[model samples]
Target: MGMRLWKDMQQIVGAGFTHDTGLPTWFEVAKATFLQETYQKWLLYKDDCVKMIETELVPQGGLFCNRTFDRYACWPDTPADSMVNISCPFYLPWFDKVSQGVVRRSCGPTGIWDEDDNGQVWRDKSQCEDELEVTAQELWLKQLMVSFRMLYTIGYSLSLSTLTMALIILLSFRKLHCTRNYIHANFFLSFILRAVSVIVKDTMLERHWGREIVKHSDVSDMLSHQAAIGCRIAQVMMQYCVLANHHWCFGEALYLYYVLIASVFIDNNKLLPYICVGWGMPVLFVVPWVVMKLLKENKECWAFNENMNYWWIIRCPILFASLINFMIFLRVIKVILSKLRASSNQRGYPDYKLRLAKATLTLIPLFGIHELIFIFATDEQTTGLLRYIKVFFTLFLNSFQGFIVAVLYCYANKEVRSELKRKSHNWRTEAVLMCCGQ
Candidate 1:
């Protein structure tokens, strides 16, 4: 099959030179794309021919029929007249000046022959490389990667700072350590860690840094692998933090729903169980996924390129959490509307529905409605204006979610403002006393 294919290729190349043949057909054009593979197969045939010559015929000295027992000796010694219709057994390197595909030269009275103006007998592989288009595509892809790195770097930095501030506010103020604030603090902490992990992952995976590591390493085999320790750690930590954030949101909704439906305050001591579930359940889910991924395909960073099952490991939990939270939200809304309906004009009721709408807007991050946008807008179709819209939308929402949480739960709250004012007044009083003493 390989020999016949080579002979047919020669005929095709010969036919290509004839003006009567006109342009190459579609199949011939398609065949031109396989030039590299054709060359490799021709090499294989040469190897086989050499092996047959080496094994079958014993060389009298270092020569065979006055020729060295090398590639030339492997050539079939057919008569010059008989070679007209028969294909040459030897492989000759030839460059297609037109289609840039590989062709071969037939053995004449002399040995294998290929001569051009350069006097180089080797194949002109320059034509095989689509340098213009391939390089452009590679550079284009690199630009996209750089842009993503910059976006995530800036976004995560902003998120990390805001989330840290939110955490400090929630933790420092005893008055703010309510059940809702506690859950929000958990989410804030998780998001902060997640942002840090993203930064670290980006740093470790930076092309220059990775290349530098390999360059500086003395042990050739040690630092040569794709899955570096730092990158793998970052991947695991990022996954854990993401899962923890989802679980914390689920915990928040569950707590609120329980309070509304059961009409009882969950004792401060009882929070230990919820805390265990919120933080520890993520470990349960993430560990199995990490172990399975390492066992199955221990490739670079356990990234998204793996089998679909690994993806479902993380996504399924988040989706389930979101679905449950949505159901809880519906129940909570039902309860609020029931109470509003019960209270008539005699009670001088405000627009509770408007309040509910505002509250739902604040809960967008918690309830996972934002995921629907990603689900419907397929990434493949997300190009041009839609791509930019998605980028900006995600940049604002993900990067500034911590800021939104702080504003809604801390700065906007009456109790937090009062506590801040009281602390400021005390600080001023103490400063005046200290200055007088000095």
Candidate 2:
């Protein structure tokens, strides 16, 4: 047994234990530490199992099979042509269930352990895998995650297309170069960049970080220096873009609030403050989060936020922006309602209702009031049907945000529509004149 283990260790370690092995990289050193701790713990477990198996009874009757150990569980001697049952092994590292069940192994008539279809000793303990069984809840969660990914993918793709067209309209015409439109252009660009970043992050995680957790996998895929850095960088970029995107949304509301309160045209010079808030502010928080992660919790591709304080570094800013936007919306709504009541009441209630609905539609995305729907939802405590609804709605809101903003601000704006119409009419007239002259 000792010789066999030593030979197996040599085979497993290969040239790793040899004297000629040079200095390894940080990843390789970490890999070596993991392997060493794993093997040492495994050896200790094997010893404990062997010590417990020593007291098992031997076969008493004639024509009986001898006792055997299969490195995982020890089988006691049993009478020929019969089955034996023993307590399930507790030392299996992969199994976490209680060791109360019995495992049955057969002794052949020829006084040998019965061979399985693969011609090897077999034992049945299917009832003992608490950690291995995929429960209905787990299956449901997996399906839900897949569906959410699909939903977000579609949403981001649509947003990308619509936002691109909106941005082109904002930029192509020189007349649309006011402070407000420039702010609109920045908002569109932020969402466009965010959509692209999200798509790339998802792809990189699936490919580089392993889409699914595998069982009993080998160490060959454990330490890829490139994939590790790539996925972490992707995560960082996604976070930065997310912060920038949210800040830009807040910038939209800020500009709107300013315009409403000042009741005057904003100077192009005022655009710089909005740009700084939208593009530059995320760096302050993201840098600290990244530094803490690198120094404290660097594992798992910097994907998990096991530390809530660290996670709040990103969440707090977005929440603060949302809260401020909500307050601004309340004031803006007061102003809007006052104006509507003063101007549209003489036009009749039906026309007033139509204008109010239009204003509500525009304000929801503009002020990010729609996001307050999910603010109180804690995904961890949710269960059953409500959880599904919340998750789906949250994904829906996140995925289609760019599209909603583009619709409310650019595609649905009167100025944008008029500009497009004028441009089209001018191009058609120019084409007619050239044709006539030719």
Candidate 3:
């Protein structure tokens, strides 16, 4: 049967290819996507089956499904009304492509080869179809991943460029040197680290996952064998940067609250405590998470947080900072409203309320309060449209935060704009004097 199938494949390849006169043209032919390199194994397997059947040759014992060779597997004489499974053929195209799983062949009563609706003998490699279906799903997800990564990659690149420009501008003029700009510089630095770390982590995972999944190696084993330590370090740094960025936003809110609402002055541009909270506090959570991961759930390049406890360890500080910043936002708004009311004694109540609503909307991004809606994230298991919306929004916001902050605080600031204008005028005057002298 195998030999005849092989000839049929040759015949299908060309019109005058076959030497045999009669072929089981009625038999359903397997698609010839098998690897040519594996043809030897196929022949050896087929020969062994033929020899075994010949040695144990027996007349049909009542009703029995005849021993047959189809696709690559040699089906043994199955008893009537019974089904059997054969290990999937590795030589087939999808064998090594998808992860291995259960395979089954169907048979009906009366002990004959399975028949299709057309009354033709059928090869029901149901699991092969399943593997193909899985392959299709995976292909779809891969395309989606590529698209999302592109979106975030562009965002991070844009953010990084803007942040560098903002930092340079902040540092260029000594007149702008205050506690506020100092915090801004540190905030920009955190975002720089964040963008770099995220890019690095993504690159590492692509290499690791691409190699491991395709080759059918266990993820843990692949990580252990490859650049596991470096990848883990990248993961740690990414967490630290993310923590610092969010905490710095909290610092921004706190400083505003203190100076404006509490009427307290920070003497001599002192920001040691704020600096510690922004850069140092992440260490506390990161260290513990790393220790716990090493002791408990060390595997797979440390890319995914399989342990919810570990995830919360990193997340709790970020959430705490966000929530506190939001409270400070409300407090600052209330104070500003009261002061506005006292100063604008002639204004109507409705007018002040309208202004308050605008102020709230404006402060949402300034305090990073808008992130409250996206604070909770969906996991890999999350499906359907909700998951997609969350993923896109969360990724877009996270990646472009540096650019957004730079635009709002540095590029769009009246003070910064005035400084740049003054500098430009001074440079123009110097150039004119030089030309006059010449």
TM values, all candidates: 0.64, 0.71, 0.67
Worst 10 residues of 3 by lDDT: 23-32
Expressed as tens digits, the lDDT of each residue in 26-101 for candidate 3 is: 1001111122224445556668778767777665567778776663567777777777777665444445543364
Model 3 misplaced regions, further than 4 Å: 1-86, 89-144, 212-221, 265-268, 346-358, 376-382
Clashing pairs in 1: none
Best by TM-score: 2
TM-score of 1: 0.64
lDDT score at residue 77, model 3, on the 0-100 scale: 74
Each model's lDDT comes to 0.57, 0.71, 0.68
| Better candidate number, 1 or 2, judged by lDDT | 2
Cα distance off (Å), candidate 1, residue 265? 9.0
Which candidate leads the pack in lDDT? 2
Give a tens-digit lDDT track for model 1, residues 1-438.
Answer: 223333444442332221111111212222322332434555576577766656664444321121112222134333322221223323323333224333232333343333446653323333332223346755664455456546655766777777787688779988777777777788778777766665565555442122311111211222234435666777788788878877877887877787779646555436776788679999988898888877886644454333666667777888888778888888887887777756744586677677667767876766555655665464345776677567656655665665566677667778878888988999999999999999
